[model samples]
Target: MDKHFLIVSFLFCFIVAVTPLKCVTCHLRTRTDRCRRGFGSCIAQTFESCMSLKIFQDNILQLSYMVCQKFCRDLTFDFHNRTYVHKCCRYNYCNIEI
Candidate 1:
């Protein structure tokens, strides 16, 4: 019985680990911190992760976006007088808090 329990536990862990991660999806979030478009949820594929992007103008937050992105990387770049920060994470809804 103990051996059977151990096998069951291992199987459960494996299943959970192999399952895809879920993430919050928001195309555009205004400065008011509210989602303005494409508000929903997404399931990340095996090679994807939850990503969050924040756009700042003059050091003030102007917009935010979240989604499940493939080959996502954490980075910061400046363009057109705005700074964009990209962060990636693994796990369910992790981007929501980024």
Candidate 2:
């Protein structure tokens, strides 16, 4: 009984640790700027690594805008959808796109 309880507790802790819970304070967007940059066309290019993460912690809007530019040269977007494709950058964009 003691061994079973210990194993169960360990499994429960492991499950909780591996689970990806959303950050209520810092929810990251799943959008990618590839489509905005003409990704399917000849002008399309890969996203820059330097712009992968936020440049300024305080200014999320500015950082996101700047990062979008690394993929799309045009920064004057009318809306978020116009600048980035929703839920497109969730995983392995470089490997899949290239």
Candidate 3:
């Protein structure tokens, strides 16, 4: 029983250790922005989407690359879904429909 408990504990710890620190939805939005949008609107749109999801709205500055990885995993964005905006310089943004 003790050995079984140890194995279970280790597995649980591994999962917790690998789990993303940032919220999943926010991560998805962030990754989508990175693959599609340049930077400016990516930050703004991701921030707003994170706010709407009630996840990491106030902690954008503290976000790490790992959390961003979580976003990339959850998002299905790619080169095709990207759109260009011509406000001044050519800018791009992801068009995640769902």
Candidate 4:
């Protein structure tokens, strides 16, 4: 029984240590000269990353979001008058910054 208990406890701790943490989430949209938004805590699944993005339109900050995302890589894109900035991380609330 003692051996069994030790094995189970170690396994539990290993699993918890290896798993990624939950993140905070939010969204914002800019209109003319102003932006409006809200934020909250969010849970992320295994194999997911916390993501944050800032969008610029015509060189002006226009929109932004924070989310628990499954994947992101080489993260930047631009088209026409819009630009997007992306950051991805695995720790809790890591998406809080742009």
Best by lDDT: 1
Q: Encode model 2's per-residue lDDT on 9-90: one tens digit a residue.
A: 9999998755432211112422442223322211123452212233233323332211221332222223533333221121
lDDT of each: 0.96, 0.31, 0.30, 0.75
Residues 50-75, model 1: lDDT tens digits: 99999999999999999999999999
**Higher TM-score: candidate 2 or 4?**
4
Residue 81 local lDDT, model 4: 67
lDDT of 1 at 48: 95
Mark the regions of model 1 whose C-alpha exceeds 4 Å error after superposition.
Answer: none
Candidates in order, TM-scores: namely 0.89, 0.25, 0.25, 0.66
C-alpha RMSD in Å of predicted model 2 compared with the true structure: 13.6
Best by TM-score: 1
Give the 10-residue window scoring lowest on summed lDDT in candidate 3. Answer: 84-93
Candidate 1: lDDT over CA atoms?
0.96
Model 3 error, position 97 (Å):
28
lDDT of 3: 0.30
Candidate 4 segments whose C-alpha is farther than 4 A from its true place: 1-20, 29-38
